[model samples]
Target: MERRGTRAAVRTATGTVRRPERTATDEDWPAACREAVLGGAGLLAALTALDGAAGSLDPLRGGLWAALAVTLFALLLPPRVTAGQGWLSARGPLRRRTVRTDRLVSVRWSEGIAQRLVLRDDTGRRLVLDPRVLLANPALWHLFATGARTAQASGALLCGATALRQLTERAEERTARTLLAGSGRA
Candidate 1:
């Protein structure tokens, strides 16, 4: 379906039209990362505060210390998760990638420490994008996965396998260039 800039157009082989409801944006990446870092920091701060407040000489001091620790951690930690157009971008301690809906070939759900989204190109090379930093929102993650599947099924709006492969190759080349540049070799 063809719409204005607000929606993605999907065309069938017979020239039928469909409009996709969701699109991805770039902001989702850093937000997810910040959330993860803050959460970890909060936990550490809480534990530290508890230890500091606990008195070696007083028995009641242990409970008091624990309460103080929890309070401080809650005050210091902030939630970070944002939704974007066409894609769910997330950044955490070890994750950094923009998952383009058009480039996604498959989505898999698992009961693990993190949720995994597998993207593939024409050559069958795959990139595993995991947004594990935000373990608080399983629903949102599921929504993103479902959206990816929907986008993949819509033939008109999906990227061709060959095009995806070229994109992957280009990305690798760019990474190499970046590394070389940093090393004073580019």
Candidate 2:
């Protein structure tokens, strides 16, 4: 069999990139769950103390407690990426959202020392996600462009349309090459 290049080609003719699946490790689940539980307990305790000491606490005591609670909630809610039924969903502690493969607008790597996947929605919102946070084999950058493209096409949240358009144009040449190759093979 012929050896394929390290850089996989994304074209209509070639199959879409299949990201490796991952299962949460025993440690992963428990650690995240424990953090969430601890954070909740801490927030509850702080809020109760603030309420009891309202007269003595700072004027901004309520706001401070609220902020702390929000922060704790976010930390406790683990973010997860799930792939099934022809769609990829990013489930975060605060919210859960999904995008189909066809809705993807574009995916690309952000230019940085610690590279990340910069995904754009149709309305031009950009989400810079770290691969380390996700449970997938492909580098996080690889998923950004594809996921954006898929999300866009599927009418998912249009968060960064402007950024997506700019990035797509910049990578047009490379994308064209892949498309052409795939077309030829097909």
Candidate 3:
């Protein structure tokens, strides 16, 4: 049993057991970064080529284009996401936000130009991240789900079960697809 404002202990048949803390980060982050950088470089190259062909290429114009490319790269870069036993975090170029998954109060999907998963915990800590990060990294998803399950079992999670279920279904489907593809039957 758990009390309000107190951490609960998990007991097994033999004795109390604690979950080991482990961290999992998005494994595809490097590839995504490389893509962003390549995209920026490609844009800069194309613009410079066009400007030179039109005899308008100058140092100031080239510098401006370079700056524009850098800004585009920054905008295209994704946040780095990581999860541990009881917490999940997303670090963007500007800041990092983290939430205690084991003390989650709500989980919701925010639909927009880019869909995002929003997590809020009992302590008012919140984290927003792209759901694709979890789909791309199973280890991170495992850690996140483990903590969410603990919170649900302890009645700390008051909302977002449906959202979690939807994401779970997507993960399972993706796994099945991957298996089938690997077997040449997809």
Candidate 4:
């Protein structure tokens, strides 16, 4: 069934009207961007205030400080992720990457300061995104899971069943916790 308010209509080349596939995006992107901007501004303000009180504020120095703040902002900015019926995309400050989830060849988790979910498709396309985003957005998760299942069923997915299972278990646990807490039974 097609979801309401999620699809756009398109006219195909065969003179047919069809609903174009919908894409789910990271819903918390606005808040993340706001946090990035606030952090950059706060750092810039602190540096300026400190320099002004120390009698060291100058245009060249101020320019350099501003540049630093801008750099920090760019560095802190998270990639925007979007997913469709068969594809997922991550757009960063410099470029956008997409992978066909329905033709996936590999999936894995990269451990670091922040955990990242990495996906690769049969066409050699790759994308990496934060798993927290998927946990927070059901629509995005649904689309991604559907595509992953399709790939697995078609024998295209080879290396990521464990990763996907882990995520599914996590999501289930989180849901159970939320339900229990909401019902005052936690």
Candidate 5:
């Protein structure tokens, strides 16, 4: 049996495995550029145009406008998402959130302007993340998939297994398509 420090392995319906939450590597990053600079620049320009020059406005008013412009520009910045062996993290300029991907007990999908991946782990901690984070990072996706599968096999998963299945199928399909497309002679 494999060992991860002093933490004992936990048995699941499939078999015994090391404590994933502890054994898995931390994955997540901040400062991931989403190339929103252009939009942010336009926003800053538009706000400045609408509000007029900082020099022309009263001192306090100019300072407030400058602050607002900076805030808006910062908001337009892209957030970074990372997933490691057992963890998933999303970092933004304003805040950073993380979840133990390998310990997740429940996952729910919420649709909105941006799709939300709501996850709850054994520790009672909750994380709301972008579903695109998984779609974009295969390594991160695998960590969650493994944990979800374990949870499913153990009957600890309350919901969203079907959604995970669909996502897996889609990922597999894309992989097959890419492989086939590139297999032929040029």
Candidate 6:
């Protein structure tokens, strides 16, 4: 009987563990994309300059020009993601989109070469993002988690909680693995 009671307490404690809300600032940038853009820009700039100094439009010049064009576009068009109390917004060179996390009714994982988070809110406003953006930032994750929890608690979240929960689990697992590896215990 005592062992059963202990197990129940442990279950209750772990079952109700809630992820805190998160917030994002304007300066937050996706680390992976930034690295690619910066590295590409530097390498392309060097190649383009070298091609120009060689005094001929050679094959390398054409390739460098094309690569430089792509790099510049990526550098200038990086997406800016910001998360607030109940919302997450993404702004790029072309457009800005916002998602009301509190109003989310469905969350879908579009997995492929790159994984995407597809969220549809109650008001039909949709936002697609790379989950790494949220998982990479704790404050942003907290805001999203709190909003989702509110929706789930209020019965406003009709579906997709499973997806959210799975993401949260993945984040936790990754954190655990990272810690263990760092400590040489993995």
Single out the weakest 10-residue window by summed lDDT for candidate 4: 1-10
Which lDDT tens digits does candidate 2 get at residues 1-186?
112245544445566665444222222444666778788778867786868666655548766776777787776666555444334456676676654433544455555677575544344444445434432222322444465565666676345566566655646655566678889952
Predicted candidate 5 versus true structure: per-residue lDDT over 1-186, tens digit per residue:
112456566787888664744233223332233335555556656766666754454657656756765676577665566555666666677888777766677788776698887888778877787776666555556676776777777776777787677777866776677678799732
- Where in model 5 is the C-alpha error above 4 Å? 1-34, 49-61, 111-113, 181-186
Task: Please write out the lDDT profile of model 6 over residues 1-186, one tens digit for every residue.
Answer: 001111222234557744443356434465546776677776777766777788776877778677776767566555777777788788876788887888788888766788999887788988888888777666677777777777778777887878888998977887788789999999
Q: What local lDDT does model 3 show for residue 101? A: 91
lDDT of each: 0.48, 0.53, 0.87, 0.87, 0.64, 0.73
**Cα miss at 136, model 5 (Å)?**
2.3
TM-score each candidate: 0.31, 0.39, 0.80, 0.88, 0.66, 0.66
Question: Candidate 3's residue-wise lDDT over 22-115, tens digit each?
Answer: 5788888888899999999999999999999999999999999999999999998998898887999989878999999999999998666888
Give lDDT: candidate 1, residue 71.
Answer: 59
lDDT (Cα, tens digit) per residue for candidate 1, span 80-124: 333344455544334444455544655443436655535553335
**What TM-score does model 4 achieve against the real structure?**
0.88
* Backbone clashes, each candidate: 11, 26, 0, 0, 2, 7
lDDT of 4 by residue, 1-186 (tens): 114444668788999999866778888888889899998998899999999999999999899889989898988889988888899888988999999989999999866688999999999898888888887777888888899989999999999999988888887787788889999999
Clashing pairs in 4: none
